[model samples]
Target: MTTTVVTHQPGIIAQSQVVVQVTERDWSTSLFGCFEDIGSCLCGWLCYPCFACQVATNAGEHCITPCCVPGAMIALRLKVRARLNIQGSLCNDCLVDTFCGPCSACQMHREINNSSNGHLQ
Candidate 1:
């Protein structure tokens, strides 16, 4: 008959030394850098509703997404930042949306317009 012996370490534990590194990126443009894109600025200020719809549409959301979704601006900001690898938090998004709604919209509009991909840009 063949016998098998098993060894067990009851007092020792194995740990992994693997570390994951993530790069936090910044937005291509500043939040209030509206002058960088004339078209977006004009669209945002002259016809705010139309501008909002256009921005939402470009972001792969319904044209009226801003109108339908509660706190849509903040959520959109979070989504855009996440997609672009930009570093920020929901609280920051909310504060920016609350105080600089138009500028934020214009910035996002420019960002989406310049993004290479659909909506996620």
Candidate 2:
């Protein structure tokens, strides 16, 4: 599936904001990696288990797009997307929930907290 989003790149000076037409591929690649990478910081906001879902969808010859699932898949996808859009740029309810996994934010926070605590020892 393809989605389009408009992004503005901050310019070096005022009135220099460059509006770029971002395509899904740009985000999708990172999003896909978020699902595959065990250490992604945006995993929670995009918890689609995209890898597994792609395999299942491929086997059935279904549409190779960003489709929604239920249960674990949905839950995971939401978590991943949440992590990516943690700045309140996106909403959790707007996404389809189907999977239940450690959200990227939760994981990142845990890691950060652990690292900091370790230094206090």
Candidate 3:
């Protein structure tokens, strides 16, 4: 006697075939690797809010949105992760934003830079 397995969801296997293959990639820069870009580090150190706003603007978000809304950085991080197919969770985003806010911002800046070919516009 043989057992047969069936999936209840239709086209589950077919959908997998239709899915586009995307290569997983890590963040272009490390969170604490701010020294790699002295300009960004100085901007983040001298005026954190300005740096955050610049990052937000570069990401197509309103300049003041990050300042007015709480957890905006986390949301931006998640967006960047999804766009790049990077593996990360909301909890991780939150933790990174909470513990190393400046570093996280710098990393996001670097990611945007790498993705956009050094154009933050």
Q: For this target, which candidate reaches the highest TM-score against the unseen true structure?
A: 3
Give per-residue CA lDDT, model 2, range 13-105, as digits (tens): 546578885332112232233344454434344553453344233223232333443443344334433434322223342341213233422
- The TM-score obtained by model 2 is 0.20
**Regarding lDDT, does 1 or 3 come out ahead?**
3
lDDT of 1 by residue, 35-81 (tens): 89887887788887788787788777888988888898788888787
Query: How many clashes in each structure?
Result: 0, 29, 0
Please list the C-alpha lDDT of all candidates, in the order they appear: 0.81, 0.36, 0.85
Q: For model 2, what is the error of residue 31's alpha carbon versus the real structure, in angstroms, after optimal superposition?
A: 9.3
- The candidate scoring highest on lDDT is 3
TM-score of 3: 0.79
lDDT of 3 by residue, 50-81 (tens): 99999888887899978999999999888878
Clashing pairs in 3: none
Candidate order by lDDT, highest to lowest? 3, 1, 2
- Model 2 Cα RMSD, 1 decimal: 18.5
- Supply candidate 1's per-residue lDDT for 79: 79
Better of 1 and 2 by lDDT: 1
